[model samples]
Target: MTVPAAPFTPAPMPERVTIYEVGPRDGLQNESAVVPVAVKAEMITRLLDAGLPVIEATSFVHPKWVPQLADAAELMGLLVDRIGDAARRMPVLVPNEKGLDRALDLGLEHVAVFGSATETFAQKNLNRSYDEQFAMFEPTVRRARDAGMDVRGYLSMCFGDPWEGAVPVEQVVRAGVRLLEMGAGQLSLGDTIGVATAGHVQAMVAAFAEAGVGVDRLAMHFHDTYGQALANTHAALQVGVTTFDASAGGLGGCPYAKSATGNLATEDLVWMLRGLGVETGVDLDAVVDTTVFMADALGKSPASAVARALAGA
Candidate 1:
């Protein structure tokens, strides 16, 4: 008697996924060479053309910290008209009250504030203790929300940190809860150092769920340094996280973490999501074309597999 093998069943996933494109902000922030405002505007326009519903346009951080994004105000001015589009959003990073003020002055309606779960990263990045960092975020979040702006919070090093070996899942959940309570409409869990494994991702998401933070209020941001980003994203998807952050052409890395590489590439995420029959409303071919154009401007080839394959084909 010949035994028939069972059919392989794909894991259940969300019917539609929302990709938060962070290439213009996070991606360009790490570049050693500064990109022109015109080029940055073009990238944003092309991303919108590719149908990305949410794009992080720029950061209001101090130039001393990230000179690559020094033209943040200028960039915002260039996109002032597009900011009025109701179908899409352009969220800018506001580090504190000062950053928030700059964003508000530009009439920006959406903003993101960032914090870290690990003490070392908080100290290194913000030059403050974890508690102090949250204190800073409180007023920023309050003011931003009071101004009627949609606020998103980013909790970095949620799974692992370079200084701290492995982060406890509870620590990340606590940070996320605090951020959500502080008035963040959405929270993004970041693997700042690219040390997250699929198991770590699952455990972290489960921990958040246990804390009463639903998957609807959360997003995933992974780095490809260990080549585990896609695997980790799969773990997140299985847990019902529909929003994932990606950088077009895999453009950025953490300057604070030297070993950290580019983010999970937008093209790669779209490729996986499309194969899973998940809808992202992103045109993969158009995204690849944008990346190809960006790579030429940056004088390098794209870091995404899909972009490379498409370019070759």
Candidate 2:
């Protein structure tokens, strides 16, 4: 009999990573049942306590679009005092000029604008064509920057679209460049339907780099629909991407894309990163505890394998 082949080797990875926790906003936005403001505030506090430096606090989207997050303003009011002295960054999602106005009114310091790479998703999600969406984003990004708030842009469906299927690498690069040129300080490329493979991840990052977008100014946002988020994260790490987006308890999915599942779990990412000797500055045990608490509130076990194993132990 032939001897077993040697284990596969991974590419080089960064020493440290910035885990951009999006549980409070992207994680909870897709919930059909409304989460109370007090619970939401507690989740944010718990995540901060777990040492997540950058937390996406909430979305200022209209209630008609995301009724689950209708208490965004109230939630912010409750946490404003606690967040003031903390050494953490809280960014809220603002869909348009109106959304930006609401966030600015609350004296928020960081905000994120969302765009779609494919025309089908753009029209379906934002009710605007691809170009029209950028037109809306320009004014919002400029105004947010002028107000001294750091602006982050999210480019959705970067890899594959449920309707369009297999989004072109060039298409994603073009949309990302426009967002950067429009004054977004950072851009998060999203695998909206969780259809991206490790090879796709590597090529997409390379394509963006070739198009003049530095890895430092970019972040990867993956969903685990096909169970590839962690693998995709590994691929991205090899390409020198230091920032990643994850949700606690693996919460949230894309409402528009039925196949989309929960985002990559922060606990899972932390576990993998720790095993690789990567520095995330986040306490993994604390994150597990936080997700357990959130799972209790949501009346279900956490979707994270790491959290589930630790809880059982």
Candidate 3:
């Protein structure tokens, strides 16, 4: 076979980007069967070895709500013992003050809280109204900040909501600004149903910039239900957003939003970034191998295009 060469020019993007791995928490939560805690620990270990800087270890949400991660405490204990102080780089999601208390007891230094931009999702996910959700997060963020923990605020349904059709950019910005004002060090905007296109992403980020939210404090979390996650990511990169939320093997979806699908695959993102001459500090081969291992554990093939192609090869 003759090798065909395709010449390309790279787009202007950040020199180095941070991949916030969310497979262990967000990915596993939607699993129908509960994954063994040991398997979860090994997965995180493998991802860390693959050079993912910040991995979401688990969620402190009630077991009744997310039973998949019911072993949050035990998993964190094992991870801390195995990785030592590197556990500081692993952030856990906290739903409320109770969740924050659980994380604090673990000596965890990093945490995140999930918020919704739409009223219906807020009621379904958090059981609070749009404006009322802030009250729920206020104390948790305040106490976390007091403990010197870096709190990340996740604003879901930034582009579209299932209950409500398209979300206004102004609505997302207003909700996101409140999270930052509540002491969240970073704000991750979520395209919850994966209905966002590249233009919508650019406009959303631009709106945030107009509201005085710098790119440094923003992260993009895209879902590939419509096969638009990577394209949306490229749009984000064009605007200088340096952090992205991805799941190993593309193994995450929103449990609350039934229409939501798997997250942007870390391997796919790494492949694109490598091709673009962007630095992400990720080992592509290691990530593919890890995804294969996890796929065996789950009895499902990886959803990542890169992982599927590399594994078959």
Candidate 1: the clashing residue pairs are none
Summed over model 1, clashes come to 0
Give TM-scores for every candidate, taking all chains together and pairing residue i with residue i. Answer: 0.95, 0.95, 0.97
Give me candidate 1's TM-score against the actual structure.
Answer: 0.95
lDDT winner between candidates 2 and 3:
3
How many clashes in each candidate?
A: 0, 0, 0
Q: Which candidate ranks first by lDDT, i.e. highest? A: 3
Which sections of candidate 2 miss by over 4 Å? 1-11, 85-88
Q: In candidate 3, which residue pairs clash?
A: none
Backbone clash total, candidate 3? 0
Candidate 3 structure quality by residue, lDDT tens digits, 1-313: 1111432337777888999999999999988989999999999999999999999999999999888989999999999999988875689999999999999998999999999999999999999999899999999999999999999999999999998999999999999999999999999999989999999999998999999999999999999999999999999999999999999999989888999999999999988887777789999989999999999999988778899888883
Model 2 lDDT at residue 212: 86
